[model samples]
Every structure is written in C-alpha cells, then in structure tokens.
Target: MEYICSVCTGAYILGATGLLDGKKATTHHLALKVLQEKYPEIQVISDNKVVHDGNIITSGGVSSGINMSLYLVEQILGKTAADRTAKTIEFVH
Candidate 1:
C-alpha cells in the first residue's frame, strides 16, 4: 500500500515505523533539523514542499498537502483528472 503523510509530524510516525528509512522525505521547515537529527537514515529535504520516495510521500506542512493530493491524483488517475479536480476545487495548482 502507498503512504501519504499530510503533515511534517506525520513523517515522524512513518519514520518510527521504519518506512522512511533510507528514503527522501521532508517536513515543516522549522522541524527539518529535528527530523534529520532523529532519523539520520532519512534524507530530509529542506527545500521541497513535498517529497516522494517509493510508495511514501511526505509533505512539508498542511498547505503542501494540497500539492501532495494533486500529485497523488495525477499519479493514479492521470494529469487530466488531476487538473480537472484542481479546477473544480478552485485550486490554482
């Protein structure tokens, strides 16, 4: 199954489960240092709003979840569907 983490802290939960080991991930900018310190095995991305590695996807914060959701939609249903969904929701991206 695929895992999508909507918030920074959610990545911590996945990390604890060893799902994020050796994977690229991200969290809230403020917590980036903490995440790296806690999970040295994870390559914490400090600049990305969303990070996708394998079947797990992690977003920086609440707002980035929107991007993550759109990405998931595109991945599973294709870009046309994702674009329509974004437009229907009045989301700019």
Candidate 2:
C-alpha cells in the first residue's frame, strides 16, 4: 500500500485514508519507525503521553489508549463523567 510504504502503515491505513491526513498521530513504539518514514506529513510525536492532533488521536501503546480514551471522555462529559467511566472500566491510571 502506498500509505504504508515506509513503516507498518498497514496498522492504520484505513484510518489514515479516512482521517489521518493533516493530523497528528502515533502508533505502537515498535511501529514508530515505519510510520515516521512513510507518513512524513503526520506529526509523529513519540514523547507524548497521548498525541492529539485535531481529529487524529493516537496513543503510544495499549495502556496509553486508556489515558487517551479517558481524556476524550473527560472533554465531552467533564471530569466527573470521565472518572466514573474510568472507575467503571477499572482503569487505574
């Protein structure tokens, strides 16, 4: 695939085609290298606890996905709502 030519673009090629262009995102650290090389337009920030570039939000790893998801929930429903969801999901961090 042209999109994943550089890295493991296969991971999110569909997402990229649909929503990743002109946005920011990150993938699993193991997939970082290829992502960077393949998608130079994407701001591949490896240091972010959670990378949010407009509509494209990418987490470093599975654990980070929880954080990002909570952040989104908090944004939409406020901290109280997010906290409740986190608690319901048993997400500690």
Candidate 3:
C-alpha cells in the first residue's frame, strides 16, 4: 500500500511504525532537527519540500502537500492527469 504523509508531523506515525527506518525522508523545516533526533534511523532531509522513498511520500507542510499530491497523482495516473488536476485546482505546480 502507498502512504502519503501530508505534513512533517505525520511522518512520526510512519517512523513509529518503522516504515521510515534507513530511508530518506523529510518534514517541516522547523521540525527537521527534532525529526532527525526522534528517528535516528531515518535520514531526515531538510532541503526538500517533498521526499519519496519507495511507496512512502512525505511533505514538509501544508503548502508542500500540494506538490506531494500532484506527485502522487502523477505517479499513479500520469503527468497529463496530474497537470489537469493541478490546473483544475488552480495550482501553479
């Protein structure tokens, strides 16, 4: 199954479940340090708004959730479908 964490805090759930162990992930910039400290097994990235490792998709925050959504749509459907969805939602990306 695919997992999409809309915000940094949501990653905690995945981390707690050991799904993020040894994988590259990301969260809100403000929580980057804490996330890293909390889950030393996870490679918490701070420079990305979104991180996709295997079936897991993690975003930094609410705004980045848009990008993550589009990415998921693109992955599941196609770029055209994702672009159409973004356009319908009036999202730039």
- Arrange candidates, best lDDT first: 1, 3, 2
Model 3 error, position 77 (Å): 0.7
Clashing pairs in 2: 7-34
Return the TM-score for candidate 1, rounded to 2 decimals.
0.92
Which one wins by lDDT: 2 or 3? 3
**Lowest lDDT 10-mer window, candidate 1?**
1-10
Per-candidate local distance difference test:
0.87, 0.65, 0.87
**Residue 72 in model 1: lDDT:** 88
Cand. 3 Cα-lDDT? 0.87
Question: What is the per-residue lDDT of model 2 for residues 1-93, given as tens digits with 9 covering 90 to 100?
Answer: 012211223326734574666666777788777777777776676776577665455677677767877877776779999999989998885
Cα lDDT tens digits, model 3, 1-93, are: 666565767888888899899998998888889889999999998888889988788999779988998988898899999999999999998
Q: Please give the TM-score that candidate 3 achieves against the real structure.
A: 0.92
lDDT over C-alpha atoms for residue 69 of model 1: 91
